[model samples]
Target: MATLFLGLNANAARMDMVDVSNNNGYMSAAEYVSMRNEFGVKAVTVKISEGGTYKDPYAASNIANVQAAGLYVNGYHFARYATKAQAIAEADFAGQTAKAAGLPVGAVLATDVESQEANNQSKATNDRNNAAFMKEIQKFGYRADVYTSGSWANNKMTIKGKTGWIAAYPYVVSGKNWYSSNHAWQWSSTAKFRISYGGFDVSQLNSDYYTAGQKSKVKPTNKAAVKANNQKANKNTSKLVASAKWVKETKTYTLKTAVKLHTGASTSSSVITTLPAGTTVKTDQVIIQGGYRWARQPRFNGYGYLATGPASNTLEYVKSGATHTYYTVKYGDSWWTIAQRNGLSMTTLASQNGKSIYTTIYPGQRLVVR
Candidate 1:
């Protein structure tokens, strides 16, 4: 499930914004509110810096206004020089701001690691410094999350036990998927908005706000617990066997050779394997090794090995009569697709079919096309 997340950088008063010469640099209270309402944004993250010349003049009031409008609020800090002392100061500033604004629901502190100063620390050093800062902030009774680009988070930083606010715009990278134990994802640097500010246009900032939901749905704190539970649940299960015999549904499957294996039962597990189709296996043996469950061999010969190539077949003309219509199941389709195809909402479809969207549907399931 994808949850909408909205991020507002209250550090428009910062020098970087001023230097960008964009109208989004400085915004007024009214403009901010209008933008939030227009975007249906649920959260706003204000920026606090340690020693930056630019400061948010209305940080407190901005946060209050956002919360008053019923949006969740959080605070961030630009780690100038990326030192333990600097991080501590930045964390202190963030804590003070959060306390002043009464933001209690969302994450409290974020380390903005980007800097132009010569004193800016290396990735590892900055990561450690930010971690130190977060540790101190945690002492002040607030949860801290790290804000960095996808590359930095995956390749450079190494701060454990902290949630991540990944910045991966345009097309979200594999590393940007927050489902891998991070808390939130920043999908875009430009998002659409309706607001104007002090000689600055809040609308200009809209371009940087496109992002996708996390791929992995597990929360950071509970990941370990969930993994442990899952491991325990599958402890006795050992190798997954075929629930039913399935033949090659695609041309990629070969005969007799040992193909790649998957551990999980779903398509997500399929991604981690190098398995080919059509390989003959034992009736109750696991065929693939993937994340969650193993692929069980299909029950019958033709049903299991029927090769369906990856090519998409476009059935342009369906029977005009209400009796024999055709529908296509897409990559992201579930019961949701069937409902949408019939011009019905999820609730209506659920009530009519007596089934939830979570109910599994297989390919070629005869659904109402009319």
Candidate 2:
């Protein structure tokens, strides 16, 4: 029930933690520092290995840089095991690979088990194989957890007593609210970060994975100390700086459906007014809270949070006020797609917006298309 701010996951897209198609990418020391200072990142989970073979080339550099930046660095292995033997083999490889990549022992090293082969197996088989993998991973002196989608975590496998990192993105997240209880909740794959040109995968952790892991002089050999540490993590109600960012440029949106504007991000908050359909509202910021995407509209007294639509997208509640005037970027939007939607080339659109085609566009950014 407590809210604990946590860090994010990084793969080929290191500093920004953005997901790119290619398997290799870089994140500089400065970028890691920005992530820690600007975003309240306490730790980062980097991809280390896959199956029994592939080692992420960026893993060593990422671990070294994050540690040098004064943040905990964890690792995860992508699993491709259908049998117990294969799972054990993969775990051995992951353990060695993580060590080679500079992943410190005792830091969390989760096994990513969302592959098609694992999903296709029966629930019992999947659980057995995953348990085998996790047990093997722990022998290398590292904490282990299973990372999988919410559905797979429940139906395809069981995480009854074991630590888990479940992935499930809802329309709105009030704070640490998820479908299934777990050690960590990977709430968004397209989470927008200020320094990033694209969306990044972000998670909320509810464990001592980073906090206790960092401070402890040695691994807690006492079971009581371990239990107490986990309890403390769960009871930690430390307030986190709201990740919502205010945009510099404002844009007008004409409502297609009537919507209640609230005083706060959650719907349960006091309602300020119910703007009728076709109402044109100018908004400067977008917030993801209480399971909805809220547009912050400037009211006479102050600002009101208007529920534009589900967190997934806002196209259903409102549309652009006029043609070729301005457009606010949304998650999953790219320069080319925005240009195509507005009937212009990327170069033309960028030129109109006082940017270049190479410029990075992010959600809540306003672009001129005229």
Candidate 3:
């Protein structure tokens, strides 16, 4: 029994929380780090196990990888119990697995109890087992909850005390549309979008539910660990400031003609990226390559080799009226790559920033992406 969901997302804090299972395909930490930004998620849920001992092999990796990415993490255990004792045992397994897998500071453990096998039992039996699962998981010192279809919750499954993570596809409205109080509504079964390979089930925790879930997760007890997390946040803030400074101290320029930004200092090397005529160029330093002067930077990732002076591209510094501008360079970004990402032509990008595509752009160099 599933209820339809519809309504403007008027309630719930509405933070992006996506759930993934083995069906979503394998994703590594590197992939999660690089692609997680594309989805703008606040939290991620990974399937941990089913029944009493059946574990999802990739659950450990997915949970650990996402937690490492500094996102709020949650784990859900699929239920397949016909009795309270079995439900309790499975609940314990889910809780222990989450702890063993390093499921971040404020992670929730959810009981996914929507299997037809479980539902085949009388509604009375389903209600007892589902409640038992939630209760047992909560006993393990976790912020435990339940996830099910709206119809199941209404007529079949019964979980009254704790929060209910409802999945109501088709009607697919918002958290507020559901009559269930303080519920973390999952409005769809068909994932709305994709991050890497397959789609993911999306849900939102109303502000109250979201905040409560976050607050319940235990904090890192080690002083050093707390300091490390703080340092990561502080480093990002400092990097942002440095990028703003670079924009202030630097003058913007555009390429006057087309030029090849190569992988090495010499033109014989493969082309790293191309700069069409009129591409904005920015560079911190200039180097001589093949008896011709070229703009070079330490952070350009082996790209942006253009002969200096008025011949290949004119070097002119311009100014902007904006309050601030900055773009943090990623691990494998060239000036051309950065320009392409921002939808600007190579010439416009290089010229506006006055940087050569060959500038060695480090992983953290602040460039003006805008």
Candidate 4:
């Protein structure tokens, strides 16, 4: 097992931990060793469950690997409940899944409540639901925390004295006093690391955040690792960029249903505002992320992404003009050929109507072309 050592620069805040989910895929013990030795990571939290039914497939391996690499291992659940009953059920699922995934007793188990439905609820309701969840998860002998954005941590729900894990990504991450109210702050989702596709979600934890036993087992750090860690934490190498695919053509679209506009393409991105149904706007690009098709609409200072519809289909939420044009499938027609003939990319053509390049289109079947 890996052990965390004291930092060389005592004044600089430590980027204490990194959290992972199925989105990050599988990581080996060797990979975690790199995270510890190279990046000075002290702990890891694996996503264990979501809602009441879904369990993250990667949780078990991740938990075992983190322990094998000698890093403190904990678990978190993606919450989807709005009512007390649902919260209890979800909490039970999270606890069971965490135990099954090898998370030891007395480790922290967190509830990640960032869904649009949960965020839209009244504060009283959210407070009640969060309380119910935290209370229920403690039955399994794990400490609990509510994981949310810094804004939600401050404004939306009460933590009931349990230390909260708050996330707020600013363009630049520096200083010792960022997000001082919470026990832990997830400062960067795009933190530079050798693991994963894009970047790791790096967090700074209070010195006492981990259990006493976990902290007691710490090993001493060498000079090189401590120096590298401080430099990276104070000034990360990567800059935040909008994750969207721009297109050459700009088109007008009318919203078929009300949808939230996000600062970025993913649903997990911060919500800017909600646009009502029948809203019309010109979009310069389309981003297919998190199973959704987000249209880049003009905003005051920059652009916001409106989730027009599922990546499989956008016609349900938006149309190009007063009405949409469709084409009937005929003999020998293919998605690529049809898209080429209509001057559209096969990806856009298929995604516009909730179909894929592999979707079977028989003669007389209709497809949205415009």
Candidate 5:
């Protein structure tokens, strides 16, 4: 069959998501499910190697956990070579990494080629090595492909039989532009793939790449025969977790009733805004005080607090990666008192945020709690 790249067609199949990585960090299976469920991610592509030999320290763990989450996975090798000889070696290295990580036959082996550094490589060199990279991986029994940005104009490389994964930032890419078979699109850098301290790069996948469709879609010819097999497989699934850690619903929260924002987690604290019923707010820090639930308004439009009571029943969400929570000084608050109130270390908190333990805090001065 001739090769083709299709974007997400909700009716035809589901819109799948992918993430590429190279040891900046790794997510636990719980972490993966938490983030992926939030965005409906479907698969992940791990960075197995660089050039012909350098390996990603975290690829193995990431692959195992992501697969455990019941997501399809592929492996990729970052190209740094300039010769056919090096290209072939890098391809083999990638295959080894993938197989070692438990990726099976027919998994897509992608080449992440971009213009960021070019690392002083010439176009001729890039094209030659890139083409060879895809070809050799295919020979190793993979569904190989090339990844790049359209702006780089690096389309001169060969991908006639393989897929083209494009990184066209700030655009909602549909894989319709290059070589007539761009199989994947990295739509943006601002979007989060893993919403933790920092997130991973995310992309969308063509159904062809996930047709076997991860575990939840597993199809068996004989249900009676597969039941025993499934029982055995379940015993080995320690590497995966499903859904986000705390996402109860989709992004953008709506208030069920009227609410108020308080300076602190108290109903009697200074009210910043009394949001009417059905008002909207972004999820941020949520705390409990004085028999009520409080949420922080960290954004400009509704920057204040919202409390949970008869008037409002929703609590705010605090991001797990937030470093410090600031507190606006009140008339009687002191450095020591602030630290004591928030359970912060007075000296370390003051110095790190740029202040002194003895510095007199004033009313209205926002200070990082010690």
Candidate 6:
């Protein structure tokens, strides 16, 4: 079938496209759902591994949520291995996972490859590997497509007969463009739309442009199935929370206390409660406040008491001798200034301090003034 170019303006149709690669930081299942609902994402592409090695966490839940939303869903795998056997194995893994999850009809299986130096024999080998992978997926009775950059398609990969999902962001290349002959063209990287879950800015691409025969086969029964699917999905989501890593360590305190307290400006003023010595708070919950923003705590619920007037900026101090009188440097503390005030020399002071003449000292840094 000939390739189709779904123009950028056509994105008003409310299609949400999600890139589920491992590179895009970790997102919890709840976060994924929130993002989907917030951004109105209509489709999610779960990224499986290249060599059929690893699957992401909450994969089942993510798929379930997408299915419940009555949106199109698909899978893509990074093609790290350029050999036919490796590609086939990766395809097998994707096919099994997709079939198991009962992905909706008209969904696609995609291969994502980019410009990278690899042990693959040649560009032809990469092409052969992708073709082999697609063939494996076809064995399981599903359609497969290739996703590649425009430059890569023109310079490296060749797609003559196979359906290609071209990534030609920024602008639609000319009709004779490398990716123009693709089954679907990713025209814009920033396409805005709304979904039932929420609204989001998605990329402009022909997500799944079905041929006449394929389009006819898929009946629009998704709307009717949404409510029932969502009920089951909510149950699955609850199960996901149980498996989630939500220890107290993850809770963060924005404000010191739920209510703000006033502090009197005096040395004996008990403005803030000191944490017990050796009391260890979770790394995730405790955030170090500094600078101008330190005056107020973060705005959140259930935080403890507020801290007043920069509680001992330094956390630890080394006790030296009977007393440790740390002195701050005054203005005009040059070699001449030191000699006139403390009777020290330019060379002697520089050598004793292990500093050059050009060293720029700060206001509060302690030095051996005596």
Models 1 onward score TM values of: 0.41, 0.53, 0.50, 0.63, 0.49, 0.44
Clashes of each: 43, 4, 44, 4, 7, 12
**Ranking of all candidate structures by their lDDT, best first:** 4, 2, 3, 5, 6, 1
In candidate 3 the C-alpha lDDT for residue 315 amounts to 31
Strongest candidate by lDDT:
4
TM-score computed on alpha carbons, candidate 5: 0.49
What value does the lDDT take at residue 31 in candidate 6? Answer: 45
Q: Report lDDT per candidate.
A: 0.41, 0.67, 0.57, 0.72, 0.56, 0.45
Over the stretch 1-370, how does candidate 4's per-residue lDDT look in tens digits? 0112226655444557889887565677887887777666788988999888999988999999998988988889989898999999999999998988889998889888866557568889998999899999999999888887655665677653337887765444433556665678776665555433335677877645654345633433445755664565545424433344555537788876577888987767898888888888788887555545568888779988876654322243677775578999999999978977876656567877887778887889998886
Cα lDDT tens digits, model 1, 1-370, are: 0111222222111101110011123234454455444433434566544343435555666566555644445666655645677667767776775576564643456665533221224666766777787887887677676765554564456634335655433221121223235545454333333333222111111211111121212112323433343333333323333233323321122332223343334432342344343443332332221111122444443212111111011011111112335565555677756765665545445544456666676775554443
Candidate 3: lDDT of 261? 70
lDDT, candidate 6, equals 0.45
- Kindly state the number of residue pairs that clash in model 4: 4
In candidate 5, how many clashes are counted? 7
For model 3, residues 319-366, the per-residue Cα lDDT tens digits are 222554678878888876876566554544565577765656689877
Better of 1 and 4 by lDDT: 4
Which window of ten consecutive residues has the lowest lDDT sum in model 1? 11-20
RMSD of 6: 27.0
| Regions of model 2 farther than 4 Å from truth | 1-24, 213-370
lDDT tens digits by residue: candidate 2, 1-370: 1222232211101121222111324555665666566555667788888778888878888888878877777888988899999999999999999898888988888888866466459989999999998899999988888887765666788876337877655433434455335677676666443333344566765555534344422221233433343343334234434455544437799987677888987756898888998899999888654435678888889999876755433343677776667899999999989977865657557876778889898999999866
Residue 313 displacement (Å), model 1: 42
Angstrom error of the Cα, residue 114, model 3: value is 0.9
| Residue runs of model 4 more than 4 Å from their true location after superposition | 1-13, 160-162, 195-197, 216-295, 298-370
Candidate rank order under TM-score: 4, 2, 3, 5, 6, 1
Positional deviation of residue 76's Cα in model 2 after best superposition, in angstroms: 0.3
lDDT tens per residue, model 5, 1-370: 0111122222111224556564235456875675445445567777777766677877888788887877777888777566778778878888887777677788787887642223236677777778787888887678877776554444335444335776543222321332335566554433333234333455555435543444443222233323342233234323332211211322345665455556665444686766775676665555433323455556665446555421112232222223566899899988778766765446545865687787777899987652
Off by over 4 Å in 5: 1-15, 22-24, 115-125, 153-162, 171-180, 193-195, 210-370
